[model samples]
Target: MRTTDLQLASALGAWRRPGVALARALADAVGGAALDGRLRVGSPLPAERRAAAALGVSRGTLTAALDILRVEGWVDTRHGSGSTLRLPPEAAMRLAPVSAVGEDGAIDLRSAVPAAPHTAYQQALLRAAERSGPVLAESGETGPGLPALRSLIAGRYTEEGLVTRPEQILITSGARAALALLTAHLRPRAAAVEIPAYPAVLAGFRASGTRLAGFRVAADGWDLDQLHDAFRAAAGGVAYLVPDFQNPTGALMPDAARRTVARLAERYRVTVMADETMRDLDLRPAPSPLERIPRAVLVGSAAKTVWGGLRVGWIRGTAALVGELACHPLCEPLSAAPTQQLVAAELLRDPARVLDHRRTALRRQRDHLSGLLAGDSRWRFTVPPGGLALWLRLTDVRSDVVAAQSSAYGLELSPGQSFAADATCAHHLRLPYTSPITTLDRVAAVLDAACGGQGQGPRVPGPGR
Candidate 1:
């Protein structure tokens, strides 16, 4: 993919800074873009002259910046052809922070995934092994998903007041895959998504070349007027929503907002894709939005509730839509591993015990982390009713700089801009409470030092600062 000068400039938001070398800042911006998957590997960059013009920088400065990128192996420059982006080994690991362990046993707070229920998981695995014979005896080809697992998931939705059928479910490897498949099948020209949403969602839509129309999800909750405008503008497109315990911010869309979204979606002829991955982590009771937006295609996953290792997720839509997705070329005929499906099904059969255990732990951790953050006046946040992370607004610090400096303190932080559709939310940061209370206490200390300028480390100034 060839990145346009305009796009590159947009990605290099606020590269110019006081007391910072322009060339180095430009290089850092490029590296940041590469690390964030914005400037993808092998992406051809615009010519140096054009890029410099776009950035309002001189050609000499651009050349020096390119030299830095080349030295850092973040870009490969050729005499005839232009420079192309490269993903350094360390940057590659940073991109997959969820699975990557930090050096010197650093604390990793980049991912919001929860810890698995060990005893319940062990029991589920044993039960799956015991029940494997019947599944193995069959051809082992499930078109949409394992029927038993689909039935279990559909039954759970039904119990939640949403009438669902097994036929309406198409299981996938995980929620991410489910969403990718939906986007591929829908192939909408534009998509309406919540600003400061899940990073993976934004990256996925951008990768698919879909124009995004973002609606800000404030700290309180969704603004129905803004949501209605976004829907009306993106009419005949698609809207991806995470109304139940929205990621990052953790704001739960009220029942009234859900109904308004349903009505607007219908009025504007928009296809609504509701992500319910965080629904099970509810610290407060809220009605399922699916009941209000019956036409919306819902996505669910066991990764959040039961275990991240399960990798079992499903899409719930009209039976016809399910059939279409099942037959879609992009859709893999076979679902996740049979063993995983069996384990997920076993866990789902009686999930209350396991879910309750997880919810209890998460609630305690959330409160503990919130209490810790409340001590500092510089940090202001609303304690979300549910969700794995807290979206914090830093009063006098830039989240990007703080996150960049946190590495020196052995803390891996996810800056807020990663979750934005554009280069906004620079003052925000997301800290997950998934870690143990002791670890969160340590995290708070590291965050305080990092934000308070107590550490001696190379700090990248915020854009235009």
Candidate 2:
């Protein structure tokens, strides 16, 4: 779908700020719009001279802006048809954060979960173990959650500008569990899920009998129109969104779009579930407040930030709603293990350390993975600002096919097709760089071979390993 001039103008509201370079601003505005779903991927952008004139800038500036988008994978430029707003894929967009380790025999590059900062975790665990002994003996099917952890979780959100109370929070086994509780409680007839979503989330919605209407999320962001349209099409039901550093794609929902969506949700009696599971892994300052929105539920977790093994995730909403949700049969008496709670609480006590350690460790791993795949032209690694893995774009191939072949090469990779709501994203791959740097080298080689030397080789089927 080619973006109309008026559409582009609206998305680029004030493409030119006083001191900001016109070219740079244009690129950011367009990229931001694409990332948030206001602009559709593959939508044709205005011609250089025409766009420049429309935005009251010189054609040279527009050309430079397009170059920026091209380099960033926001748009694809062709000689005759001009540039198009696109979410083709990204540098590391193909990677998914997985827990697979090479020690088990497979060079698991299939997932993008962060490598737990061992030293910090070891220290935190020691503290938790010491504290858990006393806390574990007296728990009596603790309702809502471990009180201290819930308070801590609530406090964490309070600090982030979201008003949350322990009473308003319900701790579950994991993010999936919390989501499952929400789906069960709301029991919407239909819902809209932003695609390239976490697989388990999709599963949760389906298991609860909610028909999912697909909405597209690009490497840049989401198309708000698709989001709003999906909501209306779904009769203003529930909308499940990963607004912060979304999994697989690494696109963060902008603040402006959040406001608009919040209004739309209220207007349509829609329930928006914002999953902030990766919010803690963000590499930069937040573009918007992670505050509670009206008629919405906020899901957060320490699984990604602290340790995935510690199944601690929560849902924050009005007391009435949370109370209702807690009664759902799906919401069992969840006493998230005492030790895990203690470890989480201890870790949460020093939010700065968790943030710093995650940022440093993930950044290092991202750089390591990028360096390993840097020479592979067929795979473009866009160092995401935050998340467990990189979203990679395959030059010309089906990700599912690539994934199947990669297994024979001893690489456990999750194909991009697994992340999309349908088959529209088959040309991508998710590579979670959770393994050690040394292990990543082996992963790159396996990928290179599986791709058939620059990804054009014949598909190699395994002989039943």
Candidate 3:
């Protein structure tokens, strides 16, 4: 593919880190493009002087950047011919996940998965294999799910204050599959999901062709009034709620709010889908009302509480509704991955031990991050009770600018804009303190430098524009 100076310039211009050499930053940008396949291997980079002019950088600076890329083996530049992306097409296309620091030595905070305790997880797997069942006869996919796993899940829910039965369960491939299946079942004309929701939820609605509305989660907790308004605004459509440990923000809805939300869902006659993936991740107990409502469907997953790679999730609702959801074209019968199911069930057997261990470590990490941030005034946040990351508001800086520029400083961050339904939280950022404490120390320093020009104020989390 032929490339132009304008295209390179456009891609490179988005990143700008203060205190970093212009050439180094530009090199990281160019390298990122090459790794991502935007700069095809056989395609020559734009003519040097012209590329520099187009990118508004001095020609010398551009040459330095090119040299860095050449040294990194991403590009090969000839005296007479222009530089070309050196990564082979197939290799580039199949590139491994780029490390946050691999491009420019940035500390990575972008990936949200938590580290599972290796010993505990492996032990569960061993126990599952020991208790393995005879291989079932050949059969095509059937969706109601493994009878054993469903029964285990039902009993688990019952203990959590929600009375459930195996008939009310529908096993899904993962949380995303559940969302997609639910979306297909509702066939909504309109929808509302908490702003900064799990990205898969947004993608599900988009794929299902539903127009969506958003109401923000208050920084402190759920704002029932906003949620009610959002539900009412949806008219007769559907609403997705993550009342426990909401992603990005980590706000656990108070018991009062949970009942109020249930009331609003009924009052507005909207089908409610509550995500309980994070409910199990909480250090303390939160409200549980999944068994109370008829129209509201509840989904739970092992992705958060257990290992993320475990592709196991389930939906809880009336038997009839769950039966209908199970038949969704997207639903399949991996519900009984012999090893996966047994491992999850074994872990479920000791939920308290596993969750308690995770909560204790997470709280320590959270406190470590808070202590690091005590002297910095550029960003602020109320420490979440329990969640994967810190959702912080940049006091006086544009989150977009900092996020864009942070790549240059060796830190890859999720800009708050990605979570906003309307991209209005450009001044916010979600930083994971879940990483190693030593790593968090470096991240704090980098963050402080990045927010050098940010303002001083607190902005309420509200519906983004």
Candidate 4:
């Protein structure tokens, strides 16, 4: 088994199974697929919890299946490692549909994580690995990442009409690390964020010891007037804005509003950190404020468009600020992983091919999940123009209650309040459909059952309701 196949230490306490029954059950389901020419070598198995729920078994049972696959030459087990399919690449195979959560399993749709894709990308990694030694070390005095990567990333902004140089680019581990460095350098006096901001960002700002002041995103879009007032209130410090395909509410700030907010930021002498991580995924044209506001720090990542495993992201701002942020990164993560950067560079080189494949797959999965939600009237969601998740509201105001009950049925979820500043989103929930199309269906079925199905219980009240 390849070293990358497992991060075994993580699998120990939570995943080890003692009985053969659990092992036998797992072997039967996944093994049956393998022998039937379905699951192939290099294919990634679903997470143990996900697989167990889908197969109507315990995690121990799922581990046993993996163990069996190892014994029968259908799968290989790596110590403190990941699982791998032992079947040959030439074997004819079909994706066996599996649910994100089964009747007896807990489905976590709170975060944005695609069910890990099969090992097609492993080919890119292996190819990169062969050239790793020299290429990885050839960055000269700059260390880690090569000049070519920085140039390629800078080219992205140049295409968008912002002239950027490689010297001005500083590649980071991900957007999260980029934000960390930004927060590290800045004084955490008073920072402004959308009322319901990305929870992690809020946590990061809090960790920086910033007094977080919130500006409410209007139900329709960004509340520019409130945003302006908040900036005026904070006077300076930093203001975080997600102008396109925003998390939680899926609100898109109009270009005019964006411009207004930018002007306000300038007027108040505040720095606008515009997070565009989810910007490019828009199914529609998303007007960006950065076009007119050059001072805005554009924090972006490949994690959204490509797989999160790539972990390559960049930050764009004025040359001086970018340089400052670049220097700060050495104190944090230093640089993005050499191997991941190479893979990302390859995908970026031929973005159309990768994007086409990703969009096609995501479109299918998105539609399937939407269809499932549409079948049930107890849930309400906006058909987002773009972005990874759907913000759903229940017909009843008891979302926390429903979420607790759903957990009882083995379905863990993100309650709306978790994403809010004051935790007032008690009536809401964020449903991210990042699992396989089959899993999306299962999640919908479980949600439908939880909501008491079509006009059966409380009618899902609209936003006002």
TM per candidate:
0.74, 0.72, 0.71, 0.72
**Candidate 2, residues 1-465: lDDT per residue as tens digits?**
677777777776644433457787688678656644567777788766667777777888888888888887877777787777776433222122333545445666654565454556678889887877567687445557777888988897788777788899887877887877777677888888887888888877778788888888877888888888888866756988888888888877777878878887877778899888888777654434444455568888877776677687788888888788777776764436556677778877886755665576567667766765665667675777778788888886788888988788777788877777675678888987666443454566667777776543223323221
Clashes of each: 1, 45, 6, 14
> RMSD in angstroms, all models?
18.6, 17.3, 14.3, 11.8
Candidate 1 — which residues are off by over 4 angstroms? Answer: 1-104, 285-292, 453-465
**TM-score order of candidates, top first:** 1, 4, 2, 3
lDDT of 4 by residue, 1-465 (tens): 222213322222122222325565345445434433445546655566765565556777567667667775677656655577666331211122123333124466656654323344555667677766876565433332467788898898888788888776667788887777777877658787897778999888888788777878733677666777778777778888887878867677776887787788888888888888877665543434334354787788877766676788877766787667656635336467777777777667656644544555556556656765664557677767666777777777567777776666556678877777667677787777655543454466556656665433222222111
By lDDT, rank the candidates, best first: 1, 2, 3, 4
Question: For this target, which candidate reaches the highest TM-score against the unseen true structure?
Answer: 1
Model 2: residues with Cα > 4 Å off, grouped in runs: 1-101, 115-119, 122-126, 129-139, 285-295, 333-335, 371-377, 455-465
User: Which tens-of-lDDT digit does each residue in 214-317 have in candidate 3?
Assistant: 88885588666677778888878998888777888888777677777778878888888888888766644453443333457988888777666777888898
Please, what is the whole-model Cα lDDT of each candidate in the order they appear?
0.80, 0.72, 0.71, 0.64
Candidate 2 TM-score, C-alpha based: 0.72
The true-versus-predicted C-alpha distance at residue 247 of model 4, in Å, is: 1.1
